[model samples]
Target: MKKKTPGDVFDLHQKIQSELNAQEEKQRSALRRSLSETKAAFDFFTDLGHDSTTAIALTDIALANVLEE
Candidate 1:
């Protein structure tokens, strides 16, 4: 078996950190997309004469359900 050096350990740590950062960014992107879509849906319903308060309440419920997942 090959003995690992300090440089190898550092490189492995960097790789893991990079992977974690990428995953976090992906999650943030997904959250942004969900929020944008929710806004669009809310606007569509409001344009069709839905009450703003009711729409907001429903949007909040929907977002809560989504975040719970």
Candidate 2:
């Protein structure tokens, strides 16, 4: 049986930490790209939402005016 040395353990720990850091960086970059895409789409949809709301309000006003007779 071989005895484990502190240097061996430290090297293994460092390797694992380095890999984790690299993977985390990849995830962060992907998230940023995804967020930018989503935000653009979100802005477009928000404009559509405002237009729809205005249309709906106009519809309701027209209906109310008709019923006032």
Candidate 3:
């Protein structure tokens, strides 16, 4: 078998580094997507809570009017 040269070792090291960088980028992208989804879910729940409160208040007012009649 032939011995490897320094240039060959350097190329291999660069290849490994590129692969690691790609993997790290993918992880960062996934984390960003997860955070966006979580924020959307939080906003949806907040809106739902606001709607529920408004509905309850309207219902109470309706009940009071009916009782007074």
lDDT, candidate 1, 1-69, per-residue tens: 999999999999999999999999999999999889899878877887879998887778777887799
* Model 3 C-alpha lDDT per residue in residues 1-69, reported as the tens digit of each score: 989999999999999999999999999999998667555544565566656556556555554675599
What pairs collide in candidate 1?
A: none
Better of 1 and 2 by lDDT: 1
Write down the lDDT of every candidate, Cα atoms only. 0.88, 0.72, 0.73
**TM-score-sorted candidate list, best first:** 1, 3, 2
lDDT string, candidate 2, 1-69, tens digits: 888799989999999999999999999999998667555544555566656555556555554675598
RMSD of 2: 13.7
Q: List the residue pairs that clash in candidate 2.
A: none
lDDT of 2: 0.72
Quickly count the clashes in candidate 3.
0
Instruction: Tell me the lDDT of model 2 at 22.
Output: 100
- The RMSD (Cα, Å) of candidate 1 is 2.9
Pitting candidate 1 against candidate 3, the one with the higher lDDT is 1
Q: After superposition, how far is residue 58 of candidate 1 from its true place, in Å?
A: 5.0
